[model samples]
Every structure is written in structure tokens, then in C-alpha cells.
Target: MRVSANLGFLYADQPVTGRIASAARDGFDAVEFHWPYDVPPEQLRAALTAGGIQGVSINTRRGNLDAGDFGLAAVPGREDEARAGIAEAVDYAARAGLSAVHVMAGRAEGEAAGRIFVENLRFACEQAERHGITMLIEPLNLRDVPGYFLTGTDHARRIVAAVGHPTLRIMYDVYHMQIMQGDHVRTLQGLGDLVGHIQIASVPDRTEPDRGEVDIRWLLDQIAYSGLVGAEYHPTRAPGDWLRDFRSSS
Candidate 1:
């Protein structure tokens, strides 16, 4: 299982561009971003080329944080903003040579929100397909993100099935899953090809995988995915130190 550093959390002390170089220097061949809109695509591409690392995936812009907007995609009456964010993310991912775009389903509920989410996902899938990029939707845990639209593996699967688009798939974050539900091994194994990307961090504390209550290494051994597993966790020590320890122990 190859691991990619999640620049959003792994190297929080450095600038995004510097995080790419740091990830490369630490032997990571791939990295993922949360919101890199502040960084120009050309600059990001240049940094990735210089570091000889691949930029794997990025999330769509979360709308108006000050206004309590976690995402725009599923919010009623915000279709324009949602689609705009989707277009921007897909375009940016294509320009930066990223393989996928994660569409965030904002804090919403009821049948109306569900319908809006499906429609937005279809739009995102269509745009992503034009650039040969995959579109992903993640289920955020309610504890950390209360009122989040998507919060379970089954819900994500149903949404993907409803869209019926090949480019659209689920971004399974183990940390969130562990919080919202247990039985990670069975859940992931059952999801199979529906899962487009995977992310990991410790449960309850949101720290290094090795420090979590879950036996991450053992859990990883039971899975059969060949794609890059994102190391998306906050580190208490130097990121490299925990990485080395985790790898050596593995």
C-alpha cells in the first residue's frame, strides 16, 4: 500500500508549495491538497515538477466560511455557487495534473438537499469526465462536522448509484468512518470499486495512524486496494519522524 502525504495536514507548518518539496524529500511520491485555490496552478505544477511528486487530488472550494458554509454543492438555492466551485476545481485539477476532484456536500438535510447533491454530482462528473478526471464525494463524520449532508458509507454508495456516472465515486476516509461507524474492514471490502480514493488518520484524536485506537497497519493489511492511501493526519512530532517509525514498524 503506497501512502501519499496529505499536504493539508501532514506539513501544516510550511507553505503549500514547500510542503510538496518536503513530502518528496521525505520519500513520498504523491500528495493531496484540501483547498489550494490560493496557490496558482502554474506555481503548483512547477513545484510538483521540481519535487518529482504527483499531485493526486484536491477538494472543491468550501463556500463562505465566515457565513458558516462548509460547502456549496448541496445547499438549496446555491446551485450557481456550487456548480461554479465544481467547475473551478475540475479545471484546476486538470491544469495541475491531478487525478481526482472531491466534491464537498455542505451542511444540509432532507429530501431537497439530497436531490440538489445528486444534481450537483452529475454536473461535477460530467465536467470531470471531459478532462479524464475522476469525481469523488466523501462522508464527513457528524461529530466533527455536525449537520454534514453525507455521513455514512451506505449514503455515499447510494448517492453514487443514484448518479450512475462512471466518473463519480466515493472518497473513503478511514478516520471519519471509524468515528461514524466501526467495522472498517468489512465496510471497505464491500465498497470495492465504488471507492475512488482512501484517506487515513487516527480516530478520536485525529493524529498519526500509529497513535490511533485502531490498529491501522493491521487494517491496511486486510484491504486489497492498490491505489495511493492518503496519510491525512495531524502530527504531534516532526512529520518525518512519525513516517519513518510507521514505515519501519510496518
Candidate 2:
């Protein structure tokens, strides 16, 4: 199974560019990013080329942390900001040679928030299609991110159906789903093509997959997903050490 290192969590000790090199050295097939807007696209592209690995995906910018904005897409009265973030993400992903962008749904609720999310996603999909990029929406666990708009697979699926756009799809994260719901294998099999990306981390503690309650290797073997599986875990030690151990065990 091919794996992508999630730069946001793994390799927290290094800079973004350094993390790319570290991921390459650790035998990762690719890398994924979260809020990498601070790094210029050209610089990131060069780093990826030098590391000899591809950048598979990145997240749209989080609006304002101080204001407690986790994202902008699903928030009512923030359509312009959300669309701008979508445009920026699409353009950056194109320039950085990334294939997908995960659009974050901010802290929100009620019917109006849902309506705004769907409309913003439609606009995002339209922009992404022009560049041959896919738009992803992930269901974050409310415990980790309270008030996060998207919090369950079924809800995310409904949103995708509402958007009815080819480029828009779900990012199924094992850790979050395991917290909100169990039966990972069945859920993944059921989602099928609606899933555009997959991410994994240990449940509850959010540690390396090998050290968690879940049988990650078994889970991997049961699934027939042909895409890169993101290792989005918080490492207890050097990430390379964890990867080496995981490789040997697998």
C-alpha cells in the first residue's frame, strides 16, 4: 500500500520543505498539506521536485484563528471570503502540481449554514474543474473541533449529493470516523467512489496507527483503495522511526 505523509502532523520538528525531504527519505510515496498558504507555490513545487515525490493535496486557507474561524466555506455571511479562499486554493494547487484541495467548513449550524456550504462547494467545483483538480470535503469530529460544520459521513454524503458536481467528493478520515462511528471497513466499502481521498491516524489518542486500538495493517489489507493513504498522525518520536517500524511490520 502506498502512503502519503501528512506534513501538517508528521515531521512537526521540521520546516515544510524539510518535511518533504524527510518524507521522501522515509519512503513515503507523496505528501499532503494543510494550510500551506505561507509557502509560495513555486518554492513548494521546487521542493517537491527535489524530494522526488508528488504533492497530492492541500487544504484551503483558514480565515482567522483569533476570531475562532476554522474555515469559511459553510459559514453564513462569509460567501465572498469562502469563494476567494477556494479560488486561491485552486490556483495554488494548480501551480504546485497538486491534484486536489480539501475545502474546510467553518464552525456553523442551522439550515442557512448548510445552504451556504452547498453553494460555495458548487462554486469551488466549477473553479476546480477548469484546472482538472478535485475538490474534497472532510468530516471532522466535533470533539476535536467543536462546532465544526461537517461532522459525519452521512451528512457529508448528503452535501455532496446536494452539490451534484463531479469534482466534489469526500475525504474519509479513519481517525475522525472511528471516533464518531465504528465499522471503518464497511463504511469505506459503502462510500466507494464518493471518496476522493483517505487519511489515517490512531483513534482517541491520535497517535501512530500501529500503536492504536485499531488494526491498521488489517484495515489496509481489507480495503482495495488504489490511492495514496495519508499518514496523518501525531508521532510520539521521530516520524522516521515510526515509519521504519511500520515498514518492517507490514
lDDT of 1 by residue, 1-250 (tens): 6789999998888999999999999988699999999999889999999999989999998899998888989999999999999999999999988999999999999999999999999999999999999999999999988889999999999999999999998899989999899899999999999988888898879998986579898988898888888999988887777778878877
**Residue by residue across 128-237, what tens digits does model 2's lDDT show?**
99999999999999898999999999999999999999999899999999888878899888888898998888877999888667888888788778888899998888
Residue ranges of candidate 2 with Cα displaced over 4 Å: none
Give the Cα-based TM-score of candidate 2 against the true structure.
Answer: 0.97
lDDT of 1: 0.91
TM values, all candidates: 0.98, 0.97
RMSD of 2: 1.1
